[model samples]
Target: MIERVKKYIRENHMLKAGDMVAAGVSGGADSIAMLHILKCIQHDMGFELEAVHIHHGIRGEEADRDESMVRKICEEWEIPFEVYHYPVPELAKEWKLGEEETGRIVRKQAFFRERERMGFPEQKTEDQPQFLVALAHNRNDLAETMLHHLARGTGLRGLAGIRPCGDGIIRPVLCLERREIVNYLKEKGISYITDSTNLSDEYTRNRIRHHVLPAMEKEINPRAVEHMAETARMLAAADHYLLEKGSRLLSGCERKDGYLFEGEFFREDQIIQEYAVLEAFGKLAGKRKDFTALHVEQVLSVSEKGIGRYIRLPQNLYAVRQYEGVHLGKTVPRKAPESTESLVKREKYPAEDFWEIPVPGSLECPFGIFEAKIFSYKKQKIEEKKCTKWFDYDKIKNSPCVRTRRQGDFLVVNREGGRKKLNRIFIDEKIPASLRDKIPVVAAGSEILWIPGGRMNEQYKITSTTGRVLELHYQGGVLA
Candidate 1:
């Protein structure tokens, strides 16, 4: 088993000489076996080894015992060790996430923190050795994950299950089965602590492990886990191939706002198109948490719709069909305001919902800091700039607030007090329909005082009768 793991690590290019490797040891058979194997091969492999243990804080005394056992093992072997404790249940509530997801997040945080403490560089270079975290996922774990994803309706990436290595982490014992890990530990007379939760079906993975996998092994095939692991590897290879080809095709589709998939993009095979859309969405979202195959299909469906048609997606993103191609971007603040009576009835606004501009002070908004100051009128030229504007302090009937456009939003179009709806101005300016919602406006009641990149209300223009000039400057918001 040790030799086989060594060969797998080498083949995967998981480590090199002088590399620092941290193995996650949970005091379970799988983790214990992996730690021992890596310890045995560290000198030959020319890498440094340490153990990291994470306590989920749900198992109480059992969890304490597990931590103690792992610490003792590392001490006896003279291996550097680190342990992190997290209240997963409490954190799950605080983060609005599941216990399982919370645990995974904290575990990753612990591993990355350990790497930083060990003085590993943030990025890897050709001349430098790597800093890797080793996980103890076995063939059975891979099979279980595949089954879980299948039950949840997964895509090719989900069907591929776990990889040998990714994102600065490696699974050195992924080739081994659960039974093999236990047999090896028993042969070596090593003891391990088991969590009581594993015996219950409270969790989906636990149910699969306790019932579904065992039934499949007994009735369907004795080597079901092994065969599933093999199948996952093949699927991973195919997924990788599609990802590379799709990425190459998407390379030229990059746009200032987002990727623009031209008509030529539709000529590719449908599978390749799906992969390319997946890649683009992932890049825009920064993470693919709730983005599933259904969302991918929605994005693809936009191609068949009219030019103005768009579909909302997770992470406040949208895919809109355009004359050139499909445009993907974030949803800007476009909610129109209610009637003026509704605005007057509201007593307060949450800081996140809207910002009340401070006279002679600065306030931060979606676009950036909006600084305002009131001074006696001076006989000087009002220099014009895209982000800066001036208004008559006394002519403003109400305190100005910075926010997105509202339903009755309108700007004074002439000295005669003629008004133009905000939407009409957007159209007259020929602003991209997708960008209309993102523009920030300063308003008093339902009347817009200033449009940062465009115009200020003509009613607020400074004149000989203007007693004070209210200067407003906007700093730092992306218009393009």
Candidate 2:
């Protein structure tokens, strides 16, 4: 078991030379065995080890006994020990969160505080291995998480279950089963406290452990826990691949206030699409504690409509579709960067303000005055790309107003008509941010019909089948 765990740690690259790892000891068989295993390998691995114990203030004297036992174990191992006492029940009420969530938060904060107190980590950045908080999630814990996620209706990420290392926490003992940990401790003559609450089926986790797991073992596969753990690892690898691919796709569609998701975002497989939306929410949300697969579905559903369509999410964040892209941002403007002046140029047309369009009529904006005329398809001789553009008039349902680009404006980039955020296009084309107001945009809803010299949205362009053609000619100022 020890050799298998050591192999798992090495395979995951959980530690490196000169690293400092903190083992979170709950005075239970799982954590105690993990601490011992880590201690056994630390010298050869050339890393330092310390132990941290959290007194959650729920089990009364049992909690104190747990802390004392961990302190004693740390002393015997000649390693530093840190203990934190957090009133998790009161804090849970105060924070309006469940006790389980509050306890997890408090424990994480204590671990971070301990890590900081231990002095500066030698390395920082993606390439270097992180100094981590070692957690005691065994194979059984992983199987329980998988079952929990499945019960809740989850995606690939949920199926992936508990990660070995993420956000500075490492579960080095996850490769071992709880029974294996208890047996290893017994073999080593080490005693651990068994939390009495664990014996009761009061909690959902306990019910799973005491009832569900035993039934599965007796009636189904005896190695069900190991099988589930193995499945989780495979799913985790697949999730990693999709995340990397989605990240690249996300970079193209993201904007300043939120992501301008469209085109590749929706064109990719559903797995990538779901991952992208989830990632976008994580980026925009202050705390990503409550988003779910349902939220992702809602976002995607609303994102396919015309401009101004939106779905409000938890924490006041929303995903809105405008023109060619979907934006994920707060429904209310952010407080800090509110001074950043936000998206869409606030420049008022010096010569004119925008008005709704009528077919074959003239409209005026600050940049220029444009004349629109519709003629029969046979009479069409399209000319002058600089000052004029032709569109299939019959295809345009609503009157596409000729004006400056608005807050949610987007442009279709290619002949295939994949959408790109207007701002994204400006940045991609190296159009000076200052030149945006000077650009004349003809748009209908979120869709941009023409950006004058830049592009005539491919979806609206005159095709050979065009029976009636609409010609737009700008007559005044810079665009002319």
Candidate 3:
């Protein structure tokens, strides 16, 4: 057992010379066997070892006995030991979380606190001594986890089950079967305490262990647990490879606010697209708890819908379908205007809605500053810049206002005064729906003269008979 565990540790690079390993020993058969195995191999592996026991503040005398047994074993073996007590039941209620989840959280907190107290660096580096927390998950546990995830509906990552090593934690005895661990402990004459909770069917995992797995082993394959563990290892490898590919696909799709997934993203395999979207969601949310395959599907579904459509998500995030791609971010765009009359009749508009541009002065608005100036038309070379436009100044019927689109907003599409609604123009231009409300348009009432970075109304174009030129320059925002 020691040789097999050593091989597994080496394969996973769980330790190196001068490293410190803190093992969680709960006086159960699996953890006790793991502590013994790690103790036997620590000298040969050139690493230091210590034992940690968590008292979950439940089960009364039984819990105390478990902690006492673990401490006695550590003392006899000359291994350093530490114990942490947490009121898991009380904390569960206070935190508004399940007891199981609260227990897991406290266990992790205790392990990290021990690491910090030992003067170990939080982050591992090649040149410095590394610190790791060792767990005692066996093959049977891995199989149980896989079945649990499968029953609850999960993707590849969930199906991969318990990992041998991740995020500074190591599971050295993961390759060992439950029977092998019990037999080894018996041969060594080492006493261990079993939690009474394991005997009850109250927990879902206990029910699986007591009934589901035994039925599978009897009616189906005798080595069902071993087979499931093997399958989980394979799935873990595939998941790692796909996540790397997804990360590569997400590159260059970053926007100022969040990530953008365009048509090229959809061209990839559906699985790859899902992984990329999942990664983007995780990045923006800062965590993946409660994020499921269903959420990923919802975000992807927006791609098939019209531009400006969005799905509200957990963590106050949103995934908006843009003209070019799907944008994932925390910013929620303002609601779109239903009609021009509704907008004109509103008693008030946001400060971003309107700013009058003086004939030869500058005005600041939500999108940016607009500078207007009149100059003599001497057949000067018209610069073809998106931020700068030349219009017939004498043709202006009213002072132009820099604002967002309103109902009945139209642009002159032809020399013969043919008009195009702003909504129609946006549809023809493929502008994202969310952006239509934000794009600053130079308008004279409902007649839009110029959509900076896009087209200008034909009526405002410079002509040979024009005597004065109105040059409007935009200085900021998306268009700029």
Candidate 4:
């Protein structure tokens, strides 16, 4: 078991000399063996070590015993130990979250809290190196996880199973099985605590471990654990390869606002590209992706349309198809005040009476302004003459302020005295109800001036009699 762990550390490049390490000791055989192995190697590894235990307060006395056992083991090894108590059931109820998810959150929170509280650890003097947060998810655990993900219809990421090292967590004993860990403890004459809740059939994972695995061993194959573990190991390697390749491809096609990819990318033989986009999009959303292949199909359907279309994403973000490209951006603008009570706080204004927001650039004012320079011919091609309003360079006033629409705001929408309310125009345009609060309408008193990158009042529109044209295109929101 020790040699296998050493090999895993070396193979995965998990740790080096002179590092601070924390172990999540659950008092189970796997964690105990991991803690013991680290302790045994401490002299040669040259690293500091600490232990953290999270008491989920589920099994009452058994939970307490787990914490006590971890503290005692750490004390015997002369390593630092921290314990956290969480009311998992209460939290599960309050958050409307499953108990499993609640426990995971609480455990991770405890780990981070202890990490911060302990401060930076001193460099190892003679040990190999302390493996940071060494978790004891063994081969058997990996088999179970793979089965779980398989049962749940997971994709490549889920099939990859627990990573050896990710974001400061290390699973050092993943190369060994549970029985191997127990055997190593017995050989070393080491004792560990056991949680009785694990014997119950209430939890799905518990049932898998206690009943399903034993049944599989008897009915299917005596070496079911080994076979399943081996399959998982192979799948994890292949999944990692695909994920890395996909990430590289996705990065090349990414943009600041969102991502753009050819429809063929999704249609290609390589499904990894789509997964990579999903991974990037998930990160941009600041949340885990809940999207399935069906959702991807929906996105692909819109992308194939070859016209501008918007699909609402899970977290209020939107995926838009524009001119043979797909864009992912926040669908909803950040909510801000619509009232004019804070108008007097304004400072800088656009030069002269007309604000020339400089070509090939953006101008930041009280509201958003984003602009791009396009050739006259190209501009004519993309711009909808009806939706777009161009201003004559001479008629434009340099002094302009960007603000929300107010009462009595009127725009001469047409040459025939067809005056209309700015709010009414927005409503008629079918702008989303929630977005009305965010669109910044350029105004010069009660007269609606330019809607900036959007529709301008007919009074402000440049006609055939008008001279030179400088186009200011306005979208649904403030450009800035």
Candidate 3: residue 76 lDDT (0-100): 97
lDDT (tens digit, per residue) of candidate 3 on 1-480: 899999999998888989889999999999999999998998899999999999999788999999999999999999999999999878876775456678999999999899999998778676788888999999999989998777755788989999999888999999998989999999999888888989987566887899999999999999999999889999999999999898888876788898888878889999988888888878888888646666677688778877787766657677788898888888875763333221121223353467888776656444555677677675655657776899999999988998888888999999999999999998897766655676668899889999876789999899899888888977542110
For residues 1-480, could you state the per-residue lDDT of candidate 4 as single tens digits?
677777878788777777777888899888889988888776676667778888897888778877887888889888888888999888876775556678989988887777667664434333444436778898778777776666655776676667788666788888887888888899989998777767676555776788777798899998888887677667778877876777777777677776777765666554775666666667677765545554454455556554554555445556667775766666442432233311111233322333335543334443433242322221221235432445544455643345666678788877886888888887887765555555566666667676654567666555555554555543221111
lDDT: the better of candidates 2 and 3: 3
Winning candidate number (TM-score): 3
Instruction: Give the alpha carbon lDDT tens digit for every residue of 189-303 in model 1.
Output: 9888787768776566877898999999999999999999989999999999999998987887888777878888889998998888888888998987646665666677678
- Candidate 4 vs. true structure, TM-score: 0.64
Off by over 4 Å in 3: 336-480
TM-score, every prediction: 0.69, 0.66, 0.69, 0.64
Best by lDDT: 3
Candidates' lDDT values, in order?
A: 0.80, 0.74, 0.82, 0.65
Q: In order, how many clashes per candidate?
A: 4, 1, 1, 23
Error of 4 at 283 (Å): 3.1
What is the Å distance of residue 261 in model 2 from its true position?
A: 2.7
lDDT of 2: 0.74
Shift in Å, residue 213, candidate 1: 1.7
Q: After superposition, how far is residue 449 of candidate 4 from its true place, in Å?
A: 53
The ten-residue window of minimal lDDT in model 1 covers 338-347
Residues forming the 10-long window of minimal summed lDDT in candidate 2: 336-345
